[model samples]
Target chain A: MRLKCPANFRIVRLPCTGKIDVIHILRAFEKGADGVYVVGCMEGDCHFKSGNFRARKRVEQAAKILDKIGVGGERVKMFNLSSGEGPLFAQYSIEMDKKIKELGPNPVKVALQAKKKAA
Target chain B: MIIASKKPIEEIIQEVKDYKRLLILGCNECVTVCEAGGKKEVEVLASALRMHFIKEGNEKKIDEKTLERQCDHEYLEEIRGIVDNYDAILSLACGVGVQFTAEKYHSTPLIPGVNTCFLGANEQRGMWTERCQACGSCILARTGGICPISRCAKRVMNGPCGGSSKGKCEINKELDCAWQLIVDRLRDLGRLDDYEIVAPIKDWSTERAGGPRKVVREDVQV
Candidate 1:
């Protein structure tokens, strides 16, 4: 199965990634994302002192929920990035792409028996 | 918004007992607003499943994903290829979403991740309460926005069922008598005459009972 938007990874800017509500993260997966990660401000670097922390907590919660639904929670993640950290963002996306590659095609696309092989 | 709750983790796991691989899908619409099947809730359920399988000493591969809106076909396309890799789909959406997922993925056995509850509204942060009954009709616009169909235990359209006491539902004292609120509101607004008109009996069958409802808009449909 082909990953949704496999060729393009979107960087949605919010006032803070913490502003990236849990629903937005869930919506991404629903849209057939192979994997999704939330980028937040680095520790103690948030314009809003604890917004990063809030986003991290929310992302973690969303991941856990996904896991329970039999979807691998590992597909959703939270990370801290600083402004002007272009290289860091690139590395993060690359690492994420690699991780998804390892995870292989999303099972949602293939048949159950086929998923077994992919798994 | 509808208020629903997530099913017990064990109950959900049991539903997919035969599956070696599972795909958990969360809904970003109503479920997200209700805090039941959103991303955070999805993670909690995933962890519980993982721990359960771990204890069994049987390895189970589970993948997770959240959808923007489970009721929409466009959002479901995201899972088109990814879903084929999982044995079953556990939907963390309402009943409608679970059905939609099954409809979209005809081959995959779609299971509900949450119990669809009543039509409700958010009372406040982390609080929800039943509101509209959607009784194949609407009276909220006339009743000053409060719904008698939902608040009244018997869905009395005419008035209080004569069981109301102290403005609480006789069916359950804990509940408010919907008609009482309506009467009070009308009285306060000096529109008491609105209460005198007997409402026509609702034709339930014309509503949802006619079978799954559909609408084809010339403006939007090709």
Candidate 2:
């Protein structure tokens, strides 16, 4: 099945969602990613027994840290869908793109550009 | 092991805003086990601080390092060469590690990044419960290996105080009564008879009641 996601989004594949770490999510914002979302296997359907659950917890932790640093936790989210749900994957990506547009550019990225201009 | 928790980011930023060059130091021992002040935490904190400074349009240098153990002189020595490079150091160790590091480095200002909580055991990934108070006296033999001093809210030597009900402390229903646990343990060990023996008044001097305490073992000193 051929499906399309917004061009603004880039994908980083991993063996499993459990491979995601808080640092990986935070680094995205540091590198000026306007928003970040993790898509993992549906809850309880993880091939590794609980990898998806672990990924969700890490995602929640990342969101909390982002909120604490005033980066807007809502910019990060975790969604679960089965491997067969190709259409669902495309829909999620589009939804995320719309959400990021409403939030505008990450403040950290905007400040970085301003500093470069001043220099 | 000693358990600690990270301080709020706002509070930390307030304390270090005046400093230009800063180092976020982490301890790889107890703080590491508790997921508070460790190498991973150091990196996360460094990134967060850099972002905060950048978003505020302020220029600041933030560095990160994790030591084997900050409470030991030998481990503290590892950072000696770089200690002076920063205007201030943010230590993510427990209170003991923070003080020890401060003692070793005289000139640089030391800021604590985490609040040292207590001598505790991790119950699960993110749950730590206090276990010992280092009272300088060991009475676990008589209590059937359960400590009332740290576990009991009232610290009553002979108890299941009136505040205890259904094996839970009245202070918090979620908390198990220490004396209740002691009694249960004693019964299981066929030593319920020990429960009837009234304990002597504890010597409070051994605990923190006496100013700061110290231990000396000449044989252990090199």
Best by DockQ: 2
What stretches of model 2 exceed 4 Å from their correct place? none
lDDT by candidate, in order shown = 0.78, 0.93
Task: Tell me the tens digit of each residue's lDDT in model 2 across B13-45.
Answer: 899888999999999999999999999999998
Give the candidate number with the greatest TM-score.
2
Assess candidate 1 and give its TM-score to the true structure. Answer: 0.65
TM-score of the second chain, each candidate in turn, equals 0.93, 0.98
Residue B220 in candidate 2, Cα distance off native in Å: 1.6
Alpha-carbon deviation at A73 in model 1, angstroms: 21
Per-candidate count of clashing residue pairs (backbone under 3 Å):
45, 0
At residue A92, give the lDDT of candidate 2.
Answer: 98
Instruction: Output the lDDT of residue B95, model 1.
Output: 91
For model 1, what is the C-alpha lDDT against the true structure?
0.78
